[model samples]
Structures are given as C-alpha cells and as structure tokens.
Target: MTASRISNTTGWLSFAGVVAFVVGVFNVMDGLVALFRNDYYQVTSQDILVFNFTAWGWIWLILGLAQIAIGAGLLAEQSWARTAGVAMAVLVAIGQLAFLRAFPVWSVLVIAMCVLLVYALTAHPRTRAYPEA
Candidate 1:
C-alpha cells in the first residue's frame, strides 16, 4: 500500500482503538455500579432483559477487560485485533439492548458508539488509479 493509504488505514484503526478503550472504561464503571449499588439503576432486577444486576455486573466487568485488551492490541496493529474488535463491538451493542431499561440514554449512546467503532474498523477509503502522462 502507498504511504498515504497506509496512513489513512492507521488513522481509522487508531480511532477504533481509542473508542474501544473508552467504551471499555465505561463498561467497567457501569459494572461496578451494578455490583455495588443495584438501586442505582432505574429498573428493578425483574425488569432486566436477561440477568439480574449482579450477573450483568460480572458480565460487563469481564467484557470491559476484554475490550480494553482488544483496544491495546488494535493500537499495536495486531491482525487478530481487527476481527476481535468487530466481534466485541457487535457484542457490546447487543448487550446494551439488554441494558436499555436500566439506562436508556447511556445504552443508546453506547450502541451508537459501537456502530461507529465498527465502521471505523471495517470501512476503508476507496483508492483511484490514474494513467501516467
């Protein structure tokens, strides 16, 4: 690849990495809150889509750590990170749906971010070739 093309790819990957890192941190905080203060959420345990607050807490905590590791791997330009990042983004978006009742706005925001993160990781800028004069 040309230098400019490589640069562009790197930039997009970097954006993905940073977003993954931020989202991971957010998940960690959410998990901690659920674990410690179940009442902090807007809904009761029964209202949750799948599991109770404590279970979700553990899920989010583990997912968050994995995301953080994926983010770092992406920044390092590891090939596995690209695939893992896409999977994680999708997983996080789906998880947020389960979490929507607890924090509607935050869950939606995270979903949006995950969408953008997926795009950044997957989409590549088109290149054009020109004939030499």
Candidate 2:
C-alpha cells in the first residue's frame, strides 16, 4: 500500500517510530553524560539504585543503539520492529525507574514516552502501512 489506503493505525505506528528514535538519541546522550561527564548528574554513582554510572552508561549506550536500530526498522515498516519496540520500551522504562533518583523529571518524562511508544506499537494489529519485502 499507499498512503491514502493507510488506516489511523499508520499514524500511531509512525508516531511510535519517531518517538522511539528520539528516545534512543536521548539514551545515548544520557549514557555519555553518565560516563564522561559524571558531574552533570545530580547524584553520585554510589547514590543510584542500580549499577555505577559507568556501568549504567554502558548499559544505556547499548540499549540506545538497539533502540535506534529498532526505531529505524519501525519507520521502514519492517515486520519485526513491533515486537522489538515493545521489548525495548519495557527495558527503557525499567531503566528510567532505576534512574529516577538521579534525575527525577527527565527520567519520568522518558518513562512516559516509552509507555506511549509501547501503546502505539501494540494497541492495534499490524496495518497496511508496513509490508515485508
């Protein structure tokens, strides 16, 4: 299909793709800050709930890269993007939770976006917007 034949679900899928892509970029930035610019964060590494900032940085970096790839797939309407988006959203949400104490507002915002992405990706069945090649 064509754009005219696309259903409302197409909008949601596109939204999901964009949001995931943006979030992935943010995650990469967060990771970099955590790693190289530790002073940027409000809390010290010891104060966080999960691993140290360095470890968290690596985790976020990897997660972010994966998210970016999945988001691109979503945008391209790849058949596997939906499932990957759902899984990544869950992981990102959990990461936000662990990160809440350090940056409350930003973490919450990221979590909310992740939720939206999850909802958009899973709320309805696949639409004609994307077809496997």
Candidate 3:
C-alpha cells in the first residue's frame, strides 16, 4: 500500500475505535438501566421488538463490552481488531434495530456509526493489517 493509503487506513481505524468507545458507553448504560429499572424503557418486555428487557439487558451488556474491547484493540493495532470491528459493528447495527422503538433517534445514529465502522474496517484489507515489506 502507498503511504497515503496506510495513513488513511489508520485514520479510519482510529475513528472506528473512538466512536465505538463512545457508543459502547451508552450501550452499557442502557443495559444497566434495562436490567435494573425496566420501567425506564416505558415499555413492557412484550412491547419490545425482540427479547424481554432482562434478556435484552444482558445482550446489550455483553455486546457493549465486546465493542469496548474491539475499540481498544483497534487503537492498539491488534491484528484481530479489524475483523472483530466489522463483525461487532454489524451486530451493533442489528441490535440498534431492535432498540428502534425505544430510542428512535439514538438507534438510527448508532446504526449509521456502525455502517461507517464497517466501511472503515473493510475499505482496504492490506492497510488493516501489517503492510507488505
């Protein structure tokens, strides 16, 4: 890869990392509230598009943790982070869809970010990994 492409890849990965970290924090909080204060969602488990609040809470918690770890790994340039970032970002987007009814705007925003993360991770494979000598 050219020097500029290498730099661009790193730039995109860095952006993915930062954005994932921020979004993960929100997911974590959302998970906690869902677990503890189910009423906060203002909708019963049945009302949700998918699983119950408790189940959803655990899902969000676990996914959020995964996102945080992926973000950190990307920042550290771990070899596995690129694939993980793409996978996790896709999951996050799907998860957000389930969350749409509860937080329409936030869910849409998160989905958008996830798409960007996916793009950043997939734009160039060689750049995502160690460049050829």
**TM-score for each predicted model, relative to the true structure:** 0.89, 0.86, 0.82
Q: Which stretches of candidate 3 lie over 4 Å from their true place?
A: 1-9, 125-133
lDDT tens digits by residue: candidate 1, 33-133? 99999989879999989999999999989989999999898888888999999999999999999999999998999999899999999988555587658
lDDT of 1: 0.90
Q: Look at candidate 3 and give me any clashing residue pairs.
A: none
- Clashing pairs in model 1, backbone N/Cα/C closer than 3 A: none
Q: What overall lDDT goes with each candidate model?
A: 0.90, 0.89, 0.82
Query: Model 1, residue 4: what's the lDDT?
Result: 50
Worst ten in a row by lDDT for model 3: 1-10
Tens digits of per-residue lDDT for model 2 on 1-133?
A: 6666554347789899999999999899889888898888888888999899999889889999899998998888897999999999999999899999888998999999999999999877555886879
- Which lDDT tens digits does candidate 3 get at residues 1-133? 6554334346777888887787787788878878899888766788779888898889889988988998898888887988988888888899989888876787898899888888887775453456668
Tell me which of candidates 1 and 3 scores higher on lDDT.
1
Off by over 4 Å in 1: 1-9, 126-128, 131-133
Q: Which candidate gets the maximum lDDT versus the true structure?
A: 1
Q: How does candidate 2 score on lDDT?
A: 0.89
Put the candidates in lDDT order, highest first: 1, 2, 3
Best-matching candidate per TM-score: 1
**Candidate 2: segments with Cα more than 4 A from true spot:** 1-9, 125-133
Q: Give the TM-score of candidate 1.
A: 0.89
Instruction: Write down the worst ten-residue block by lDDT for model 1.
Output: 1-10
Model 3 local distance difference test score: 0.82
